[model samples]
Target: MSVLVYTESEQNKFKKAAFEVASYAKAVASQLGTTVTAVVINAEDTSELGNYGVDKVLKVSNSALDNFSAKTYASVLTEAAQSENAQVVILSSSADSKYLAPLLAIGLNAGYASNVVAAPLSTSPFKVKRSAFTNKAFEVTEIQSETKIIGVSNNSF
Candidate 1:
C-alpha cells in the first residue's frame, strides 16, 4: 500500500514541479495510511525530498544518469517500483514526466493519468481524477491494473 514518487532535483533543490508531486504523494500516503517513498536518479539536494513529507527515499545514483533520457530513466524507475511493490506511482507533469511516465506505464501495464492531480479514494477499484486536452477538464477514471501511475499537473497540488 505504499506510494512511490518519482522526482528529480536541480541546482541543489528539488525541481519546482517535483514538490507538487511530493505534496501529492505525502497527502495520498497519509490518506491511504501508507508510507511514501521517492526515487531519484541524479539530483543535487536529494535530502529535500525528506522535507516533502515522504517516509523514505531511494536514490539510484550513477554518473551515467547525469543527462536526461526517457527510455533509460524509465527503465530504472520500472525496476525500482517493482522492488518497492508500490501500489501507486506518482509523477509530476513536467517535461520529464511527459516523456517518461507513459513508458513506465506501458512497461508495467499500470494505468496512467498523464495530467493527474489526485490519488484514488480506494485502491480496490484504483480510480483517480485527471485533466485532459490541455488542462481544460477532469474525469474520474478507473485504472484497469493492479498498479496505478499518476502524473500530476505541474505547480498544482
Candidate 2:
C-alpha cells in the first residue's frame, strides 16, 4: 500500500506545511517500503512536491472546492486514499486539517493520531511520537487499526 498525504494550499498556492507533511510522509513511506502519493486540491505547481519525495500526485482542480468545507475535503481525501490503496494517510496540523482529520479518519475507519512530532517509531505496531497534554509531555502512541491517519505538527519534520 502507498502512503497518502494531503497537501494544503491557499489561493492556489501550496502552504509551507504542505512540503513539511510531504517530507514526513516520505519518511514514513521509506520505512514502510512504499512510495508517497500526495493529493492536492485546487493547488498549483504540483511538480514541486516531487522535490519533497512525493512519488505521485493526484490533483483535484475543481472550483467547487475553492471554499473550505470539512465534509467535502474529507470526502475527496477518502476517495484518494481508497483509490491508491493507502494504509497510511498523512496531514499537516493546520486549522483546516484539524477539522478535516477526524472526518477523514471516520470515513476511512482509521486510527487518528494528532500532533505527531516525528515519524513512526515502528511500522509493525504503527507507533508514533506525539505531543500530549498540550505539548507539556510526549507520548508514544500505537495505532491498532488497519488504516492509520497521522496529523504531523507544523514544522515538526
Candidate 3:
C-alpha cells in the first residue's frame, strides 16, 4: 500500500508543514516498499506538490477548503486518499490535524496515531513511533488494523 501525505497551502504558497509532511511520508513509503503521493486542496499549482519527493500530486480544487475548517478539510482529503488507494495517511500533528486525524481514520476505517514521529518500524506488522508525554518521549505503537493514519510532528522528519 502507498502513502498519502496531506499538505496545506496559504494564498497559493505551500505551508511550511507541507514540506515537512512530505519529508516524513517519503521515508515511510520507502520503508513500506511503496511510493508517497501528496494531496493538497485549493492549491494554486499541483506541480508544486511534486517538489516534496512524492510519486504524484492529488489536487482538489475546493473553495470551501480555501478557509480552514477541520471537518470540511478532512472530508476533502479523506476522499482524495480513498481515490488514491492510500494504505497509510500522514499529516503534521497540528490543531487542525488533530481533529482531521481522528475523523479521517473513522471515515477510512484506518488505525490512527495522533501524535507521531519517525517512520514505520515494520511493514508487515506496521508499527510507527509517536511522541508520548507531551512530546517528551517516543513510543513505538502498532496500528493493529489494516490501514494506518499517522499525525506527525511538523519538523520531525
Candidate 4:
C-alpha cells in the first residue's frame, strides 16, 4: 500500500540520489493514493527525507552495518519492503544500488527495471518509461508483478 524507497548514505550524510529516489517514490505513492516510506541505514539526518515527501522513515543503525554489503543491504531492504507491504520499491541507480537492486528484486519476487526515467504510466499493469540502448532510446515496460522495483539512474529526473 506504500512505496518504499531505499536512501543510501555515506559518511553519515545522505547523497543527492537519496532525495531523488525519495522524490520519485513519493510521486509513485501519490499516484497510487498511498504514502512513501524511506528506509535508511546509518544515516544521521532523516528529517530531510520528509522534505522529499516521505511520509515515514525506517532507520536501521548498527555498527555491524557500517560497511556497505550488497547482500546485507539488499536483505534489509527486502525485509523493510515486505514489512511495509510496499507496492513499489524505488532505489537510485548508484553503484551500491546497482549491485543491490537485482538481489532485492529476486528476494521480493518483484519485477525489476533499471534506468527508469519517470513514474509509472499506470499502476495497473505497472507501465514505466526506461532509457534503453545507453540513453539513446526509450521503451515503455509493463511489469506484471504484484510488487515492482525501479532503479532510477542518477540525474534521470
Top candidate by lDDT = 2
Tell me the tens digit of each residue's lDDT in model 4 across 84-111: 9997999999999999988998999999
TM-score of each: 0.90, 0.98, 0.92, 0.97
TM-score of 4: 0.97
Q: List where candidate 2 sits over 4 angstroms from the true fold.
A: none
Clashing pairs in 3: none
Q: What's the residue-level lDDT of 63 in candidate 4?
A: 88
Name the lDDT value of residue 92 in candidate 4.
Answer: 94
Q: Write the per-residue lDDT of candidate 1 for residues 26-131, one digit (tens) a residue.
A: 9888877899989977665577778887788887778877888899989998998899998789988888778998899987788787776665656567677777
In order, the Cα lDDT scores of the candidates are 0.81, 0.96, 0.82, 0.91
In model 1, state the lDDT of residue 105.
Answer: 90
Q: TM-score: which candidate is best?
A: 2
Residue-by-residue lDDT tens digits, candidate 2, 1-157: 8999999999989999999999999999999999999999998789999999999999999999999999999999999999999999999999999999999999999999999999899998899999999899999999999999999998889
What is the lDDT for 75 in model 1? 94
Off by over 4 Å in 3: none
What ranking of all candidate models by TM-score puts the best one first? 2, 4, 3, 1
lDDT of 2: 0.96
